[model samples]
Target chain A: MESDLVTADMVEATEFPHLSMRYQVRAVPRTIVNETGAIEGGLPEHMFVDQVVAAASQS
Target chain B: MALLQGRDRQRVQSELASLANPVKLINFTQELACEYCRDTEQIARELGELSDKLQVEVYNFQIDKEQVARYRIDKIPALVVEGEKDYGVRFYGIPMGYEFMSLLGAIKDAGARATGLAAKTKAALATLVKPVHLQVYVTPT
Candidate 1:
């Protein structure tokens, strides 16, 4: 079974209060969608950095 | 305007105090305007106590323009992990909640100058020598 990690309440509780106002809180499956409307999962740290570096280099 | 309420401030302070390593927070709002600027400031301040466990550095984009361009960061409140070499790990939004773990992991990897992937995972990752780009955007929920 897929473990239920990081619940909605947990996310709300950890957010810095003032910043929370800018985001829309929805209870749907909790998907992370990018500006391009693509859903993504939690990426590993190294891979994420590599991506950013690649993007920066392309600019 | 204060981004953190008194209660949250106390909680952050206490958490920082308990950490073994200090972490540095670089704030980008000063250059790139964003709504969460104030909140990022508060986070940087609260993370001060963790200095012993991790070295935390706060940089405002207004002052650190060179670094920002180098990292190709076009957003406010991005975090970069500084290690043996700039690993280029960045968090575009305030790294709280599940993201916090990612942030901490980045810091740990940076500090150790190593990625703690399993042998099999590392072997697989080695094949990706060409390069890969990934961007993930999410709301606080």
Candidate 2:
């Protein structure tokens, strides 16, 4: 989700605990969008798109 | 020893061949007891060497106090990928497996000053009024 509208960061959870705490990541492969939006677990491509759109529009 | 195997190296080289501008990878690492620091530096350097327009700058995370503060780096094995401008792109820890593709993509996007998102997505993104920060968590393996 970077390089265009929003800047995204790939945060290694173990290395950056501060970020994980800030983002409140509880599971692996969690995508925190706009700080407030989040999607956890593996998602299908279409569902992933919907989730991203839903999450982004929420903020 | 080569960090990237033969087939991977070939793939990386080919992918980086079309670089339009220079990309600087600012890597923060320490000499002692840092897991994956050496491996991260090695990969960044190898990628840099593959492309003439790419460069890597390795800095001691503890010793380079000024650099650490400058880049807002909070931990070791951090990489700040810079292209036309600092896009606030950061990669924490070693980008391996699928994550490595993201690294390569970021470099290409930065170097070309382009984001290959779909037109609809780009248009929607243009309408964003507030700043959004994305934190994608993944296990490299």
Candidate 3:
């Protein structure tokens, strides 16, 4: 159910709109976070922590 | 399955053998057999030599339901970092590619009981007084 909302195509379509269509198309199903911003894709732990901290600081 | 073919396996074996700590691999699938076992054991042995504190523990899930439940693992081929309180860090697939570095970092962290955060990162993290739950999913390419 969650996967449907954040399919690779959806991620590519939504996140990096300025990138080339081919690169965007290839980057689908990337990291999709819930409303609370918990990512549901593979990420290095440190990078994950960095993202989380960055998001937390923003809000 | 042997994720590495021939020369790759040898290279990985050599790298693993050079570690100063022991790294453990817990095989949770009954479907895995033979060379997989031998290869994993070889890796574990190498990881052991990596560090004085390194240790590898393999759990064949076919016989260890309690351990699986204790680890809160519901999938096959999962990795658990064992150290002060277990950390709850898990990998649902074989740690390879970029994931291997994360696995090694976790192992070293556990061995040293170290959770290293850069000063700036630590300072930022300290601002979060509330509980935060994070989950990341990844497919090995």
Candidate 4:
């Protein structure tokens, strides 16, 4: 919502059962960055941004 | 059929009343073979009804290749929330339950074209050199 380099998508796990399984979504609010790094649960805005930046930098 | 009713409608209307600018909800769906497309479109329409500042546009994913590619929609029942500019905020499935709050929040943010992020966070994001894609998985409940 802020950066041009970032895009955010919210997926309803129940509606898309296949996506839930594919991403191994066993919890609510599991944020997957770049389809690789997974951040489970909600974090404070500051922490969440840090986690997302770190996740995006993952190899 | 009305998706929002009674207190919910009043509450949503109240929230939308404070919108600083106009927002557009671009809904991508197909006529057939899509289970939730109808409900998704209806939800967008209902939300559109809540605020004149918000507009809803429907496109057939199976037929509207140009729009599909323009929005980079890769799935059905998708809703793209855009303000004056495309902020790249998208919902891959129906935004019900907890996600509904997120949808409303997105509308407000997009309406203002501002994320309301703190300066620290904004500065952190400014350091990003590569594209980042975030997919948050949640349930309606």
lDDT of 2 by residue, B1-141 (tens): 888878989998999998898999899998799888999999888888799999899999989999999887877798988987778888988888777998999898888888766666555566666666667888766
lDDT of 1 by residue, B11-111 (tens): 54554454443334454556345656666556655554444655556666777778778766666666665554455456666766556655655666555
lDDT of 3 by residue, B1-141 (tens): 444557865655555544453444444444555223444444454555444555656676677888878776655455666664555566545555566666666666655555575566555556664444333443334
Tens digits of per-residue lDDT for model 4 on B17-55?
A: 988899999999888888889989999999999999999
Rank by TM-score (best first)? 4, 2, 1, 3
Compose the digit string of candidate 2's lDDT tens values, residues A1-59.
34355666787777667778887777888889887888898776557656766777888
Q: Which residue pairs does candidate 4 place in steric collision? A: none
Q: What is the clash count for each candidate, in the order shown?
A: 12, 0, 14, 0
Evaluated at residue B91, the lDDT of candidate 4 is 94
Docking quality category of candidate 3 according to DockQ thresholds: incorrect
**Is candidate 1 or 2 superior in lDDT?**
2
- lDDT (Cα) of model 1: 0.48
Error of 4 at B138 (Å): 0.6
Candidate 2: misplaced stretches above 4 Å?
A: A1-5, A14-27, A41-59
Better of 3 and 4 by lDDT: 4
**CA lDDT scores, all candidates in order:** 0.48, 0.81, 0.49, 0.90
Instruction: Between candidates 1 and 2, name the one with more favorable TM-score.
Output: 2
For model 1, what is the alpha-carbon lDDT of residue B124? 43
Best-first order by lDDT: 4, 2, 3, 1
